[model samples]
Target: MKEDINNDRILLERLKNGDISCFEILYSKYSGKLYNYVLNISKGDFYLAEEIVQNVFVRIWEIHRHIETEGSFGSFVYTVGKNMFLNVIKNRMQEYLYHDYIIEHASELDNTVEKEVEYKMLEEQINKLIEQLPPARRKVYILSRVKHLPNKEIAALLDISENTVESQLTKATRFMRENLSPYCEIIALGLFQFYVS
Candidate 1:
């Protein structure tokens, strides 16, 4: 154990000195263990575990220079993973809360001609933006969001992995959010139903 810690310290030192190969070495040593650790913590969410593990390594690579070279790599990596898991929980909670809030407030925004027109315009703009996505991404977004297909269904229909379907949807949503900004929320709450229903 002592020798292993010593080796990790040396590897971290090399990482800090900009030896990129050390990052790969550390990843090889720790990634599987980290994946299983996060998977257990996430209650058997394989994709979420994989995402968290990948993010943990990306973060370590980003902050390698600032990391202390003489400490427990296991502890450092685990701490980062734990924080990310908490963040995911927090974000998911916020999403549910926001969705509930939107549903509750949806009626307040209903039956107003001006707002109706505005929402229609926003929906049109959103469709245009989606059309601008790359072909594969656009197809995935249309199938998942417009057609209201589940990721698994979209994957089967499109002959892609569920991960790829998820990736495309994420990118498409991000692009719309970036481009549409404040109106995207309104569309998410209002026009989403209008289009789907």
Candidate 2:
């Protein structure tokens, strides 16, 4: 363990100097443990776990310049990974609630033969919500969630840092949560129960 800690310090030093090979070494060493830690919290959502792990490494790389090591670097990485997983859970819950709101309202209108009309209205509302977002945030959200672009791709396309992409997505998701919460609580609860079961 002490040897691993010493190696991490050396790897962190190399990473701080913009050594991609060192970053790769660190990633190869830590990715599996971090993935398992994230997976447990995400309920085995591999994609989400992967995203969180990537973000944690990216953050470590970004902050390497100023990072003052007070303890084990591995512990630091784990702490960041855990927090990222929590954020993922929160974001997932919000998204699930929003999607559930659309489906539930659609189901209600289906029985009355106004399903098409109701679905269109819900779609319009969702679109409007997206439109109301700040331009950068909306773009990031659309590119990532709508167009299925990875964060790195979105960052490159937008000429922004990956952290910026993550930030924009986080903001967009929080905005959606605040807007959709009142209208979607029942749906959220039902979905949560279903998932728990």
Candidate 3:
């Protein structure tokens, strides 16, 4: 076990320095064990198992520079795989819950008129929140978020630095998030559409 740890530490250093052979060696050493581990936990979902293993390796490569040389690399890899799996599960649950909520709410609304009214109310609430921001912060928030402009673009449009644009947007978002905690799910659903598009 001690020798194995030392060997892994050396390999990790080489991998961090961009050695493809070291990456291949590391993959070969761990991929089978990781795959079978994920496969068992995933309850025989072969495709998902394969994807998780691949993602683990990809993540390792991406964060090679940050990899610790004093600990078990296998543990780090397993932690990454576990986190990925949990994220997938969390996202799926959120989707299921969102659909369930929408279905329940849709039944209550029943008609297009009610739906329109509800939508208008939500939009007005969103606008009201935006209106509460300080004037400069509101402009930055609107340009960066509502108008879907990049920070650089927002800065150029407002004749400010990109850092200023980012700072103001961050403050605006923090304020909104703090005040709108109750509406987080609705806000996430609304913004997620924009993010995906």
Candidate 4:
């Protein structure tokens, strides 16, 4: 907790100075948590939660120059999300209309989970394919992809040269592409899109 606070302070200081990377890193760290927090409070109104999260970030960007670098950026964003949600609710007519619209479109909303399920199924399929890889290639590929290790780290761990690690990764990726893409078009559009495309 202390480390995260200190890190947020550093990121906030950089963001106030107009550093886009700092803003991006902060977004990556907080966006999912913020979205989930808002989504729960908004009673599973996906669109409303999404809007509040977007507004929170936009407000942060707008006020970057006035940001207090010593404070908790996480708390600041959540407070903003909460306040924005409250303001939306205070406009009772809008909330009523939004809920009415949601009730009418509940069936379509139900399909959203199916897409997520499909993505997970695709992930499982990919993992099975990975298991079929040659041993050395499999280790290098897992270290690179699943563990997200750099080529140098992978090489050091495997007691091989960086060039060898790179070669193994290349071959492993080609194998997945050739085997999976032929049967799974899901790869062409999902997170694994780069592999198939």
* Per-prediction backbone clash count: 0, 0, 0, 0
Which regions of candidate 3 deviate over 4 angstroms?
A: 1-6, 108-176, 179-185, 188-197
For model 2, the stretches where C-alpha displacement exceeds 4 angstroms are 1-6, 100-197
What is the C-alpha lDDT profile of model 3 across 1-197, one tens digit per residue? 34543498889888878987788888988999888888888888889889989988986786576566777888877766776676567567767886886787776546767555655666777688889989999988886666555564465456678999888878888877676667555555443333222
Task: Kindly list the per-residue Cα lDDT of model 4 for residues 55-171, writing each as its tens digit.
Answer: 888867876766776667788788778877876775565457557855886775577677678778877878898889998898888877774445654654566899999888888
> Candidates 1 and 3: which is better by lDDT?
1
**Weakest lDDT window of 10 consecutive positions for candidate 4:** 188-197
Error of 4 at 75 (Å): 0.7
Query: Would you give me the overall lDDT of model 1?
Result: 0.76
Using alpha carbons, what is the TM-score of model 1?
0.54
Clashing pairs in 1: none
- Predicted structure 4, TM vs. truth: 0.45
In terms of lDDT, which candidate is stronger, 1 or 2?
A: 1
For residues 45-145, write the lDDT of model 1, one tens digit per residue.
99999999998898778667767755688877887787778768865876787678768887775666877688778878878898799999999888766
User: What value does the lDDT take at residue 4 in candidate 4?
Assistant: 48
The C-alpha lDDT values of all candidates are 0.76, 0.70, 0.72, 0.75
lDDT of 4: 0.75
Per-residue lDDT, model 1, residue 71, is 62
Candidate with more favorable, higher TM-score: 1 or 2: 1
- Residues 1-197 of candidate 2 have per-residue lDDT tens digits of 34643487777776768878777888888988899988887788999888988988887676566554446777877877876676566667877886776687775534544544554555566678889988888999887766545575467557789999998888887777676555463434343232111
- CA displacement after TM-score superposition, residue 191 of candidate 3 (Å): 6.0
Model 4, residue 19: what's the lDDT?
89
